[model samples]
Target: MGRSKSPVRVITAVVAMAALVLAGCTKPGPSLRPTATTNPPGVFGPGADGLGDTYYPKAGNGGYDVANYDLDLKYDPPTDTLTGTATITATATADLSRFNLDFTGLKTEKVTVNDVDAAAEQSGAELVVTPATGIATGAQFVVKVTYGGVPKAFDEPGLGEIGFLHTDDGAVAIGEPEVASSWFPVNDHPRDKATYTVKIAAPEGLAALSNGAMKDKRSAGGWTTWTWSETKPMAPYLATVVIGKYRVKESTHDGKPMVIAVDTSLSAQVDAQMAQTPEVIDFLESKFGPYPFDALGGIVIDDRRVRFALENQSRPIYSSAFFEAGEDGTWVIVHELAHQWYGDSVAVNEWKEIWLNEGFASYAEWLWFEDKGEQTAQQTFDNSYAPADAEMWRVPPGDPGKSDLFHESVYTRGAMTLHALRVTVGDDAFFKILKAWAAEKAHSNATTPEFIALAERISGKQLDQLFDDWLYGEKRPPRPRR
Candidate 1:
């Protein structure tokens, strides 16, 4: 969160645009269809994934079951509808409630649990389904959600960009996690994460691709069904899909295949804007853990207008607009890709800790400059925050009891806390702490105290005052004389 982002501003952003796109799923608008911008449905025409497949329950699933999903959906473009189900398989844990699901804008015409009808309710944009027969430990159950709608510009309602913005040119949805939910049902938040098996049915000549390696694509029934899947579990915010008349630019990194997907209409400018995506990927691979997913690639949505780049799991969403600014592309790309390790893989327990996600991502951006063998760490540190602006780190925990949910306290100050720790704990332990954080908490949410404890354990030094001064304290320490 930036200083410009106040709590009132965030509330307005949510109230204005709550349901928007992220990556895998889509959200509906607050309008009555026909009169309002309603989502079209029932894209199931031919060559569907067959009703046998079951969809995974994202949040409300009973028990603490963590498993990957194999989603097979069938929908049509002409009717602006979808007609296919999903097959979600997972292990059920004892300590749990119902799992949450992100259904995007799809109006649930029908839902079944283990082939039995499950009752669903429409609260706001989500379709809440309480599973029947309940769930037990080690038990496996299948859920299927079916519906459809026109894709909203992949964005959240409150703070949104012109998603699928129509320039003098064509349209592409290039925002982050918000966009995915615009057209599909998925897990809305990051805490509960899973792998995705994506299949999109579009009219002929339209191309579709997602975060992972391409399994198979076929054309039939006057529509083309493109199916892609990821091997690792990713946040719902990172599971992405890019649909357009796209041309694929393929490459390889560390023996894995990569692609830069550009909509055919925008091919002329691809050479200029996307030229550095591969380079940025190479830089990130060297610093962070290995590229998070099996494949590395991106979908070019807006040629410009986007401020932040989202490391949408494997399929990163790039802004066509920022191609002209060399520094903008450098910082945003590195920031988002760093999320591959900090934000994407090891996520926040709740939305309040979004700073833990974004701040670290921003830190990763500065670190990118350091790794380029150009800037000094102190120079980068100074560049990150000037003298008086250091108060950014004073934000309280998002526990609601502690501090505001979002404030510059999270981003600038979050990074500053990390920087302050680096100064206090020394470089060796600091870097080791980071790697240990990633290695230990992969696929789980992390809190500020958890990070603090890890630092103390690794450095063999209790950082009680350091933690207080940097993280929990109400006032920031005076800036060290430059």
Candidate 2:
């Protein structure tokens, strides 16, 4: 994900003030403690309500691994209602009497576990399910939940609004950190990747766009159901559904499906930017190895409220603001598409290592410009290093706390870290490290230490001091040199 560049001091101050005002506004979800059950003593216990993530502990449920999500959804624009059934296929990782799913806002009409009626309850954002029979470790189970509501965005204090946004004509389901729970019952973290088949039913005239290749589309009565299947394992946050009037272009690139869409309300230039999808992917593949997903495309949203472009799997979603005023937003395109490898395919194991996502993508933007003869990467690195942004340097990109997840250092300084490695190890070994990392970690989760280890193995260097200074130090390190 990338936000439009703004003044550093202004953005930081605004975000800081927003955090203060919104502090303690949102309530925490229930604990992940084992709940009492009427099964054999100590044999069956409730699954933990949350995964023990360092930053967002309650972000995902524990004790089960999701395999696939089959979502059948219908939205009525006039009434702003979203009704859906989520059929989740998962395998229990431990003995369980009951388990938890991250969900909120919507009213659950019914729930069933493995074709049996199951008792369920909603507590805060957690949907606790008690199946009739105990699910043993390694046992596969199916959960079907019928639910509906007027979907609402999560109004995070400093982060702004995210999740399901009821738009003028249709709706958009997208966000970072946590958004899937607002729309569907989900595991809700990058650590648990799963395949998806999304079937969205909307008014006959509107377009409903989603990830991967379009499987089928049919119109019945006054509604149209659009089916999309993302066979690749994708983090829950990368799944999105965009519904509204759109000018869509569908074609095949290199024998793979390519679908690009722009809101009818935006200028034609947005479509032009969207047209650059194939070219950008081709360029990134040369540096990051094969593109990780089966399909590729982009979505340019008309909503101005969306200030950033998210690297949604298979298809990245762009805020129309990026292309406003006839600005050339190709760099934004490169940043998000680069995430197809760095962020989407090889996701971060923990949110703290976000630079693994943002940094590599930001560096891709520099590489793109250098390829276009606009600026060399060394020049970009020199400029960033020369600057004395104390706040940026102080907040280490590798461990920027939860509040500064998108801090400037995470992008700019993070890129400089990569360039420093290139300068230290030379171009051949540097590119090799990148390609090898993508190839080995494709469609999986990774971390900074893992990346550093890969770099060291590829380059034959003891680079602890370099990573320590660049990624963790509170003060800027010495400039890079051969």
- Using lDDT as the measure, the top candidate is 2
- CA lDDT of every candidate: 0.55, 0.82
lDDT of 2 by residue, 1-482 (tens): 12344333222322232121110001011222112123344487788877766788887787788889999999999999999999999988778988999999899999999999999999999999999999987789999999999987886534578899988999998788788999999988788888999999999999999999999999999999999999988888889999999998999888899999999999887887788889888999899898888899989888867777788989988888668886567777888898888888888777788888888888888898778766688877766677686577898988988888777777777888999999999999999999998888887778788889999999999999999999999998888766
RMSD of each: 10.6, 5.7
lDDT by residue (tens digit), candidate 1, 29-131:
1110001111123221111111110121233222333356665654444444444656565544431124444455456677776788877776544556566
| Regions of model 2 farther than 4 Å from truth | 1-42
lDDT of 1 at 261: 81
Q: Extract clashing residue pairs from model 2.
A: 32-49
lDDT of 2: 0.82
